[model samples]
Target chain A: MKEIVKDIRRWQKQDKKIALARVIDLDGSGPRLPGAAMAVTEEGEVAGSVSGGCVEGAVVLEALEVIKNNERHIVSFGYSDEEAFSVGLTCGGTVHLFIEPLDW
Target chain B: MNRKPQKDISIFDRVEELLNEEESFALVTVVKGPPVGEKMIVFPDEKSGVGFEGSLGNSDLDRVVSRDARGELTAGRSGVRNYGESGEAREETVQVFVESFIQPPQLLIVGAVDFTAALVKIGKVLGYRITVCDAREIFATTQRFPLADEVIVEWPNKLIEKIGQTFGPRDAVCILTHDAKFDVPAIVSALATDVGYIGVMGSRKTHEDRINRLYEVGVDDEGMTRLRSPIGLDIGSRTPEETAISIVAEMIALRTGRSSIALSETKGPIHD
Candidate 1:
């Protein structure tokens, strides 16, 4: 979150709608910690990351939707999910993320 | 930069300002409970009492998360916590992410040896407020330890007594002055504070002799247990730079309560 704060502030100055995604929890071995964050602008630009390059693409897509709807949601990706998420960590860990617009 | 010094600042602006200033605070955001995405900020150590803003839907939940956020801030940790919808003791309805942004911890090195410069350099790399102190005015100088944030020429014990109260569980006190005349008192005064790490640098014989001296000063078994003499891990580091890495690694392992073994020998979650 601290690392991506600068990007969020930059986008805010340009009046760009930004969505923030942070890894809130992990169930197994993960490349990142719970506080790992990524900020995505409405223009598809990205700053920081929430995973080991494995699930970040999916997170960006989720963040784009968060900016579109201006709503928040808890999204997860991993092999353990019963929903059979399209992306999973190569480390075989489950990452839970909270995606929401940086509107507040 | 656009924000003026006034009330009614948005939470997002205030958060960016506080974070840029490296202030200690917590941002709690509800991600699971009703009315999700509700957020609040907590400044636990403000003089006027707990400073807070916004809410997580319910005043009760806001109160509870604020309290927990304060604790997490003290521990320098960020994570999600569960609670009942109305902030009950053991319910899972609400999950608020407590993001703590704290100042970097302090690293006080009580010895102006050549090794002290190496430690100070590594300490800065590790994001610690490095302070190098010694009674010898000639040895303790900014020129000698340019990387040190502070270069103080004072008796080790006096130095610790003057600023030891500020030391907390996140801070470290490393007595690199193996000379017992300076180190013994430094260690004793350092023990008076609640510093999380107290490492003494010396040879095995020097360490054993320092133990006797510490005991004579009435530093009992409990106090002795906290000291890490012959400081650092068994990494077989030869040079001062390598030794600094060993000391920093030891401190990290102690803080994380990890085994300090190679990843190949370890299993389970790599990041916690």
Candidate 2:
């Protein structure tokens, strides 16, 4: 979040709707820790990262939905998903992310 | 339910202000249970105790969460914590994510040499707020080390004495000034602080001589243990850039308490 504060502020100044995704928890060998965050602007601009590029595409999709619906969600990704979520960390770890609008 | 557009702007504005000013704080958000999406900013205060800028609906919950939030802030960790309704412990009713915004750890380099330039570059990559200090004004210019967050022309010991209290286990003090007049007092003052890594660059002979001088100056055995004389791992690095990598690698190894061996050579988890 600290690294992307400038981009976030810029997007905010333009009054662009943004979705923030934060890694709230992780299990096993995760690349990033809990505080790792990523923000996506309505214009498809991105700032920061929540994973080591493995789950970012899925996160962006989630962010788009979050922006469209104005709803918050908790999404989990890992190798253990029986539903075959298509997106998973190659590091064999589980990461729980909270996706929401930057709506306080 | 849609949020009022104006509410988010103010919260984000405050967050930007705090982060820009490098003030440490925690943003607590109720991720689950009642009052979901409620947010609060917990500020560390010495006089009136930890201050709260927003509410999590229930005052009791706010009080309890604010206390726990401060603990998380001090530890520089962010995570989700579970609690019962109204902030009761041992019950899983509410889940709040406490995200701590801690200032980056500091790296005080007591020498504005070529190694200092490399160290400043590497330290910036590692997210350390670097300070390059030297008694010689000529060598301590920002032009010499443009990457350094601060370049100060002051005696190493004097600078350490002024800002030593801020040094902690997460921070490092690397004395690249091998000269006895500078390195000795620098080590003596650095030992007095809780700085995690104190790497004094020197050869084996220089380390031996400096150790004797340090002992003469009343640096005890425990203080001697704190010094990483002949600093950096025994990687046989010769170039300044390679030496900088070795030094920073040693610091990470010291903090993680890991043997600085190749991962292929060692067994067990790569990360703790």
* Candidate number achieving the greatest TM-score relative to the actual structure: 2
lDDT per residue for candidate 1 within B1-272, as digits (tens), equals: 01132366878787888877878888888998786888888886645654677777787777778888889887878889999988997899888888887888999999999789999989988999899999999899999999888999999999999999999888999999999999999999999999999999999999999999999999999999899889999999999999999999999988888999999998876676
TM-score each candidate: 0.85, 0.93
Once fitted onto the true fold, the runs of candidate 2 whose alpha carbons sit more than 4 angstroms away are B1-9
- TM-score for model 1? 0.85
lDDT of each: 0.88, 0.89
Query: What does candidate 1's lDDT look like per residue over A1-104, in tens digits?
Result: 76787777788889999998988888878888877889999999999998879998889889999889888989988885566657899888888999999878
Query: Measured against the native two-chain assembly using Cα atoms, what DockQ does each of the candidate structures obtain, in the order listed?
Result: 0.67, 0.63
Clashing pairs in 2: none
> How many clashes show up per model?
0, 0
**TM-score, candidate 1, first chain:** 0.92
Docking class of 2: medium
